[model samples]
Target: MIRTLIFLASLFFINICSAEESKPVTLNVIKTSITVDGKKSEVYDIVQDNGQEGYEGVKGQNFDVLLKNKTNVPVAIHWHGLILPNNQDGVAYITQLPIPPGKSQHYFFPLVQSGTYWMHSHYKLFEQQLMSAPLIINNPNDLYPNYKSITVMLQDFSFTSPDKIFANLKKSSKEKMASMHMDHDMNMSEPDLNDVDYDAFLANRHTLSKPEIIQVSARQKIRLRVINASAATNFWVNTGKLEGALIAVDGNNIKPIKNHKFQVAIAQRLDILLSIPNKKGTYPILAQVEGTKKQTGILLVTPDTKIVLPSKLATSDAPALNDDQERQIHPLNSVVTKPVTKTLHYTLEGNMSDYVWTINKEIWPHVTPLKISKGDQVEMVYTNNSGMSHPMHLHGHVFQVTRIDGKPITNGPLHDTILVMPHSSKTIVFNADNPGIWPMHCHVLYHMEAGMMTTTNYTNYPAPSFYTKMISPQK
Candidate 1:
C-alpha cells in the first residue's frame, strides 16, 4: 500500500512539471502610434508581458506566442529566419488562419536554434507601418563577456497607403515603356528599381533629425546587430571611419572578415564588431538607401564628447550593390560535403508595368511546390531574368551559397537570404532535415504580394488543416 501511494505521488509530480514546461511567454500585438520626423503614423507593435516592445528567449526554450490582435482588421505574425515547425510558422492562409479582430491565438514552438531573429505582421502591407520588432534568442554559454551589444532595426516610412503606391508605380512604368519605344537612344543602363518614395528613413524608429545616441567608452569593443526590417527598401550600411569585422550573417557565425561597408537587402541581418577609437569623440554609422541620396544614421559618442550631427551627408552618392562583400564570408563550422540528390531550378520573372512577379511563371496557390524527401541534399538554383534584383529568402533552413552565375564559390557561408542580380543566377544547397512546408520567396514585400512566392514541401506529408480549409470550395 505504501509503494502504491509513492507511485501516485510521483505521477502527480510529473504532471506538475509538464504543466510548467508548457507555459508560454505572452506577446500582445497591438496598434500604437509614434511621431517620427514630425509625422504621426499608426503602427502595430509586439509587446511582451512586461509591457516592453522587445523580448528575448533562451536557445532551447519554448516560446508560447499569444498574438492578441487589438486592431479591427485580421493579423498574423511571421517569425523571420526561425526554424520552427510548419504549423507555428505564422503565415496567413498558408500555415494558419489570421487572428481576427480583438481575438487571440496561441503559437507554441520550441526555439531550436540560437540567433538574432525578428517577427513581423504577415498581413497585407501591415509590415510597412512598423509592425515588427527584434526577437532575439541568446546562447547562455557563448556570451561575450566584455563587449556591449546594440540592435539597429532600419526601416523606411511612407504616409501613403501601399496600394496607392503600387498603383502609381504601375502608371509610371507604363509611361516609361512608351517613352523608351519613342526614343531609341534612352540610356536604360541604370533602370529605376525601388517603387515607393519614402517620406523618411529611420534608424531604430527615429530619423537623423533626432537620432538615437549610443553611449560608449573609448577603446571599448562593441557588437552591432543590424537588421533591415524595411518592407521594400535596401541599404548600404557604412560604419564610418571605424574598421570592423563582419562576424555573422543571418544569425549564422562566419569566418570574420574586415569590411567598411556592406549591402543589407530586405529581411537580411548583419553582425559586425567594432573597436572604438582611443581618442574620445563621436562617430556616425549610416545606412544609405540604394540608388537614392536619402539616408538615416545613428551616433556613437563618448561620455565627455559633444554630439555633432553631419549636414548634407545624404546628398553624396553611396556605393552600388555587389557580391564582393558576400564572397568574403565563410561558415565557421564547415559543412560536410554531401552528394546532391535533387536539383530545383526556379526563374524569377517580373514586370513593373503590371506590378506582377512570379516564380517559374506561376504565382502562389497556383504554383507547383518543390518536393523532396527527408534527409535529401537539395540544390536550388534561382535565375533572375527580371530587370531588377531579387533577394531570395528561404524559410526554416539555412543554405550554403554554392554558385553564382554558373561559377562555383568555395567555402560559402550559410544564408537565409541571398541577392540575385538582374539577369544573373545564384545556386544554394541544403539538406532537407526539417520536415515541413516552408515558403521560399523574394524578400521584397510587394513582389511577394504580387505573386513571387512558392513553397518547399516534404513528400507525402499531409497538408495542415489550415491549408486544407483554404483550398476547399466556399459553401
Candidate 2:
C-alpha cells in the first residue's frame, strides 16, 4: 500500500506540472497614445496583463500566445523569428485569418530555439503604427548573474497615417517617372535613399530630446539586444568610444566580431556584449540613419553620473549598409549541410521612378510560387537589379548566406532576414523540413506594400484544416 501511494503521489505531481505548463500567456491588442515631440499620437500596442510592452521567457518554457484583440479593427501578430507551425504564423491571408475585433486567438507552438527575437503585426500597414514588441528568449545556461541585458527597439515615426503615406508615395512616383523621361542626362550611379522622410527617429519610442536612460553600476558587464523595427530606414549603431563584441545576428550565434559600430538593416537584430569602464560616466548608444544625419538613441549611466545631452543629428551622414558585415559573420556552431537538390534564381527588380518592387519582375498575389518538397535542400539566388537595397525576409525557416556576388562562403551566419544591396547578388540555402506555404518578402514596409512579396510552396502538401475552412476550394 505504501509503494502504491508513493507512485500515485509522483503521478499527481507530474500532472500538476503539465497543467501549469499548458496555461497560455495572454497578450492584449489595444489602441494607445504616445507623445512624440509634444504631440499625442494614437498607435496600436501589444502588451501583457502587467502592461509590459512585450513578452520574455526562458528557453524550454512552453505556453500559447493568447492574443486578445480589444481594438475596433482586426489584427494579426507574427512572432517574428520563431520557427513555429505554419497555421499559427499570424500572417493575415497566407496562413490564417485575422482575429476580428473583440475576438481572441490562441497560437500554440513549442519553442525549439532561443535567442533575441520580436513580434509584430503581419496585417495591412499596422506595423508602421507601432504594433511591435521585443520577444526575448533567454537560455538559463547562458545567463550571467553579473551581466545586465537591455533591449533597444528602433523605429521611424510619422504623424501621417499609413494609408495617406502610401497614397503620397504613389503620387510622387508618377511625377518622378514623368520627370525622368524628360531628362536623359540624370546620373544613375547614386542609389536611392530615404523614400519617406520620417518626422522623428525613436529608440524605445523616445527621441533623443528625451531618451530612455538606463542605470548601470561601475564596471558592470552589459548585453545589448538592438532590434531594427524601422519601416523604411537602415541605421548604424554607434557605441561611441566603447568597443563591443558582436556575438549574434538575427537570434543565431556567430563568431564574435569586435567593433565600435555595426549596421542593422530593417527587421534585423544585433546582440552586442560590452564591459563598462570602472569610472562614473555616461555612454550614449546612438542609432544614426543611413545616408542621413538624423539620429536617436538611449543613454547608459552609472549612479550619480552626469547625463550629457546628445544632438538629434550627427555631424556627417552615416554610410549606407553593405554586405561587408554580412561577409564577416560565420556561425559559431556549424550547421549540418545537405546536398542542395533545388536551385532557383530571382532578380530583385524595381525602380524609384515608378516605385514598384517585385521578385523576378512579377508582382505579389500574382507571382508564381517557388515550389519545393519536404526534406529537400534548397538554394535561392537573389540578384538586386534595383537602385535600392532590399532586406529579404523568409518565414517558417532559417537560412544561411551561402554566397555573395558568385563567391561561395563556408559557415556563413544563419539568418531569417538578409539584406541584398543595390546591384548586388546574394544566395541563401536551407533545408525544406517544414511543410507549408511560406511568405518571402522585403522587410521594408513600403517596399512590401508596393508588391515585393512571394511565397515558397511545399509540393503535395495538403492545406491546413483551418485554412480550408476559412476559404472555399477553387472550382
Candidate 3:
C-alpha cells in the first residue's frame, strides 16, 4: 500500500508540471477604437481572445507569451521588468525580428520574479498608440487573501499622429532654441517639462470626467499597482484623503514608506498598499501631470457611495519632479556588496535647438557599444547634462541605484528604470550574469526615437544570425 501511494504521488506531480508547461496564454494584437471627447479614435491593444485585457500569472511557473499579430504593421512586444534570457529581450532587430502581420511569435520563459510589471511595443511609435497593458506576476508566497488587488495604467493621448508630432518637433527646433536663449538671458534655470502637450491624460483608458470606478469594501486592504505608460509625461500619484505605503518600485520590493503622494516618471511602476476607511466614501487615486494642472485617475468607492465626477484639470500646477522621494527608498532585503569588475560612464547630451538626444554625444545605430563580461559586477554612471529629465531603462536586468549626484547610497532599491534629472548624476550597479547584447536608453519615447539608445555587448559573446542584420530606426 505504501509503494502504491508513493507512485501515485509522483504521477500527480508530473501531471501538474505537464499542465503548466502545456497551457500558454495567447495575446491577440488587434486594432480597436476608443471614445475620446465624443469621438472615436483607433488604438491598438494586446488582449486575450475573449477580449480580456492584460495578463496575470503565478510566479515560479513556466509560461509562454503567444503573441498573435492581427494588425497590418509589424509589432514587437517588450516584456519590461522581466529579467529573462537575452535573446528574449524583445527589441526589434536587436534581439529578434518583429512579428509580421497575421503571424504569431511564442516566448517561453520561467517566471523568475513576481511583482507589478508591464508589456508594450518596442516598435516605432506604437507605444504612443496605446499598445500596452499591465503584466502582473503574482508571488505565490504572498498569500494575502484578504487584500484586493487593482492595476492602474496611466497614459498620455494625442489626436495627432506620432509621426506628425515628431515632424513638428523637428520643424520648431529653431523656435525652441530662441526661447531657451531668452530664458538664459533672464537667468532662469527651471528645467523644461512636457515636450509634447497631449490632448488627454488617461487612467486605464478613462479621463477624470469618466473615471474607472473600483468598488471596495469598508476597511479592506487594497494593493494598487500603478504603471506610468505615458510616452513623455511624468505624474505625481496622489492618494487623496487616505494614507498609503509604497511597498515597491519598478516591480521590485522596497522598504515600505508611508506617503500621500509620489512621483512616477515615464515607464516607471509603483506598488502601494492602503486600507479603505471604515465609513463609506469615495476616494480617488489621482495622477497629476507634472508641471501642469491636468490630472487623471480612478475612484475607489464603497457600497452606496455616490460617484462624483472630477474636473479634468487640477486647481494648481504641480511642480517638476525631483529625486527627493527616490532618496528615501531602500531595498526591503539587505543588499550584499560585490566588488566592482567594470565601470562605465555616459553623458546624457541633447539640445532643444535640434531636438536630438544622444548618449555620450552619439546617437543610436552610430553609438559605440559598451563592453562587458559575464559574471562581472558592472557599474554605470550617467550624468544628465541636457535640460530635460530622463528616465533611463536597461533591458534584461535589474539594477540598484548606488549613488545620486555623486553621493553614495548604502542600500538603494532595485529597479529596471531610473529617473535622472537635468544636470544631475546617477550611478547604478548590477551583475552581468545574463550574457547578450542588451539595449539601454532613455524611456522618453521621443528622445529614444531621436537617437538616445545604445547597447551593452558582452566581450566575445556570439550574436544570433538575425542580430547581424540589425535594422536601424529612422532618425
Native-to-model Cα distance after best TM-score fit, residue 2 in candidate 3, in Å: 19
20-86, model 1: which lDDT tens digit per residue?
Answer: 7677667888888878878888877888878877658888787777778877889888998888887
lDDT of 1: 0.82
| Candidate 3: segments with Cα more than 4 A from true spot | 1-21, 143-145, 178-191, 334-336, 471-475
My TM-score estimates for the predictions, one after another, are 0.91, 0.93, 0.93
Cα lDDT tens digits, model 2, 396-474, are 8889998999899888879989999988999999988888878899999988998888878898877656544443322
After aligning candidate 1 to the native by TM-score, how far in Å is the CA of 50 from where it should be?
Answer: 2.8
Alpha-carbon local distance difference test for all models: 0.82, 0.87, 0.88
Runs of candidate 1 with Cα error greater than 4 angstroms are 1-23, 181-190, 465-475
Candidate with better lDDT, 1 vs 2: 2
The 10-residue segment of model 3 with minimum total lDDT is 466-475
Q: Is 2 or 3 the stronger prediction by lDDT?
A: 3
